[model samples]
Target: MSKNYVLSLYNKMGKLPFGKKLFSLFASNKAPYFKTVSPLITKVVPSECHCLIKKRRKVENHIGTVHVIAIANGLEMAMGFMAEASIPTHLRWIPKGMDLQYTAKAGSDIRCVALLENNQWQVGDLPVEVTAYDENDVVVVKGIIHLWVSEKPKK
Candidate 1:
């Protein structure tokens, strides 16, 4: 089974200056559409991934808070990191759907945290929950993401 590129990179460059930004740069190209949402990954580990999305013109809502859609994108980026590193190499997975609640206006740069307990992983479909918080530590968004999981085809 092949190693995950994203995890490989974090292992090699996770401590360097601007390393987190560099990782996100790579992700921007790998998933170009996500670039529009502009996620910046700050940290990652087997159990969790952290990300930030600044409130800027590209992602700001009419009232100047980060948009809910942009917050969703941040959640997705965090989840993608976990999925890339957590799924067994011989298994394949895809997002089936996601349910999110926008609980408050994201008044500052939003911090997103995606998590999956080591014990929750299994061989079939899985649901991973993620949350995004404002600078004040208030949860601005919450999500439950469903993913379809199965064995990889013989090589």
Candidate 2:
């Protein structure tokens, strides 16, 4: 069986509308909250998901910097994409929670690099490390995303 959906879609088509569509569908069907990430998850994985938030008035904080929640969303999306690319077909997973620290002022654009090591997700709570980098590649936000992984259900 094929291992990862993003990897399969990315193999047929590079990063673009279709890849984003499939990623959105995966989120839409499973967890609607992840749909918030559709526009930001521009790249495919197991390559790091380069999530971005434009410097729009809507996303800015009172100080005119990127809002903390926006960073959180992108960081979460990055971690999710990495998980989809790394997890085996025999396993099922869902994010359990996250612990984040905002270390710097985020820029107009943010990049998140989150990856799971081989065999990292067994059959329980797995804490995956995620960090969002500012334009300077300095970490603006860092966190551990906990995902509960289990054996896939029998059809």
Q: TM-score: which candidate is best? A: 1
Q: How does model 2 fare in lDDT?
A: 0.72
Q: Write the per-residue lDDT of candidate 2 for residues 39-135, one digit (tens) a residue.
A: 3555656635666656666667899988888778777877777788778788888998899998999865777767676546689988888888877
The residue-by-residue lDDT of candidate 1 on 4-81, one tens digit each, is 776889877767887888888887788887798778888777758888998889998899889898888889888888
TM-score of 1: 0.92
Of the candidates shown, which would achieve the greatest lDDT relative to the real structure? 1
Candidate 2: which stretches are off by over 4 Å? 15-38
- The number of clashing residue pairs in each candidate reads 0, 0
Q: Relative to the true structure, how large is the alpha-carbon lDDT of every model?
A: 0.84, 0.72
TM-scores for all candidates: the values are: 0.92, 0.80
Q: How many backbone clashes does candidate 2 have?
A: 0
